[model samples]
Target: MRLTIDHRTTYRFTAPQGRVVQLLRMTPRNTHDQTVAAWDINIDCDARLREHRDGFGNITTMLYAEGPLSGIEISVSGEVVTSSSSGVLHGTFEPLPAALFLRSTPATHAEPALAAFAQAATVGRAPIAALHALNAAVHERFTLVDGRPEAGLTVTAAFARETATARDLAQMFVAAARAAGFPARYVTGYCDALPNGRPTPHGWADAWVEGLGWVGFDPTLGRSPEAHHVRVAVALDAAGCSPVAGSRLGEGREWLDVEVQVSGQD
Candidate 1:
């Protein structure tokens, strides 16, 4: 299957700033069961981007822009080829030891509700079945509310409290898989939506199996990702894996708007 993705982030503020810099993790690396037939990155604004592999072996981009300017915008577009492999992952570099994934992050800490979900996913050793079951359980247990989370509230706490946004569910998926003794990570990406301009909030979780490599599971959608999913960046938590993470030097306040569109081009 061939997939195409378009992501645009725009920022408009009341006042201009002096200098701005950001870290971008928008590039998708190759792993077994997936291929990057074509990949491209572009910045409409005046900025310089440098590529570097992080400590976890995940690709990272350092973008720097300096100006006595105001608002800025950043966008990304790409395509990929994919196929099924029993949800097995293979052929990807691992920087940190597999044990590192078992540890909890700010987003996926200890919680009773999340622990129970993870136990359900581990009923069988089959990677496909475990991940599939996890996805189904997540979808049924929580509702996809339309509001963001309060500051300092991790998905683990949110699960116990029975409240979450798309990102919160994503964190829950990762935490549950890790609790099941799998090297699971959090994924940030885009999901294609209906043509009627319906809202499509994209987020998911990835698990590392010995034979396979890094397989993705979208608990919110109740399934392993197929051709329509476009992966951007992954990390131990949702905050670290954000497509754009940076700060701007300004005086007044800042406003941000993000738009993502994905399509099955094939």
Candidate 2:
């Protein structure tokens, strides 16, 4: 299957800012299982960008802006073609390794609730069924409520409390996988193809099987990502795998707006 993706992020900072720097995880990685037919990341402003691969072999871009700037906008657009390989990533520069993923991060720490869930999960069943049970349980039992950030609460704790955003959902998925003895990792990317290349809603989770290696799962969709999914970065949490992470050397408050769009390969 083939997929096309376009993701754009807009930032508005108050007053004149001195320096701005952001790390962008925009490139669709080429993995042993997924092939990159064609991919390119375009930047609107004339700033500096440096490319680097993270510990997980995810392609990352470090960007910085200089001088008093009103706002900063970064847009990424690309296309990729993928073929199924028994859920194993092959024939690509980066293959999801076991070491990089198994390790826990701030957002992926396992708690008692997740451990108990993993213990109760129908392990003998197929991965899809198990994952479906997890998703359905999460969706049905918990209420998706919006509120201020939790007071230093981890994703597992949030699940116990029944509140989260798309990011928190991803975290919970990771913790559950870890509890199940799966070397799960967190992923961030675009969802359904939005019109005019507009950025759309997204979610992530862990994918590890006894023989299938690491795959992509969306608890939001309750299934492993097929052709519709366009993967960007994978880490232990939202902060670790954030598509954009950086700091702005400015005073007062700042505003940020992010948008994304993912489309199927034509």
Candidate 3:
């Protein structure tokens, strides 16, 4: 399958800002499951973009803009050809060991509730089977809420609400997978499976299997990602895998807006 993606992010500040810096994890790399045919990033203002690879082997761009300015716009577009990989990541770079992902972050720390739930879901099961069960269990446990969370909520908080955004859902999945003795990481990218070709950025979990390597599980969709899931970045937590993150100088208040469109090709 072939897919085209367009993602734009706009930032508006109530007061004029002096400088803006951003880390962009919006580029997808070539892997066994997908090939990047073309990709580009554009900014409304003059800025320098430096490319690097993060510890999780994700392509990252460092963006810098000097401003006595009020706002900035960043746009990214790309075409990718993808094939089904049965959720296994092949031909992907892994600079960090899988065990590194076992380390918990505040957002993904398995609290008592999470630990008990994971234990109940995977007790006495084999690794692969237990991972699958945990994935399905998480899917059944929480509803996918529309829109972003008002704030970045921890996995435990999201699990308690009975509804969660994709990021929180992935965090919950990662926490549960770790509690079940599987090394898991958070993945962020674009997904083309939404209704009416309405593209949205997505988050999922990757669990390391003894023989299968890194296998993806998307609890928001209650299954593994396939051709429609475009993998971009992976990290121990959502903050680290965020599509865009950075700091600004001289800010009173800032507002952000994001728009995305994804469509399938014939």
Which candidate order results from sorting by lDDT in descending order?
3, 1, 2
lDDT of 3 by residue, 1-266 (tens): 89899999998999998999999999999999999999999999989999999878899999999988699999999999998878888988898888888899988899999999999999999888888889899988877776765566888888788777778888999998998788999998888885342356878899999888999999888888889888899999988889889789985998988888887775
- Candidate 2 residue lDDT tens string, 1-266: 66666667787777878988888877777765456777776666668989998877788898977968878888776777765553344543445567566677766678786778765774786875676566555555554543323434577667767556656766787788777667777777766632233345465775667665566766655556655666677777777777778788988677767665566654
Q: What overall lDDT goes with each candidate model?
A: 0.73, 0.67, 0.87
State which candidate has the highest TM-score: 3
- lDDT score of residue 247 within candidate 1: 78
Model 1's number of clashes is 3
Ranking by TM-score: 3, 1, 2
TM-score of each: 0.86, 0.83, 0.96
Candidate 3 residue runs with Cα over 4 Å from true position: 195-198
Cα-based lDDT at residue 25, candidate 1 = 81
The digit string of per-residue lDDT tens for model 1 on 1-266 reads 67777777777767887778888788888766457777667766688889988776768888787866577877777777766654445566667777678888866885776787678666855876787788788877886675444556687577875656777777888888888888888777766632243444377888877666677777767777766666667678888787778778888788777776676765
Root-mean-square deviation of every model: 2.8, 3.7, 1.4
Q: Is candidate 1 or candidate 3 better by lDDT?
A: 3
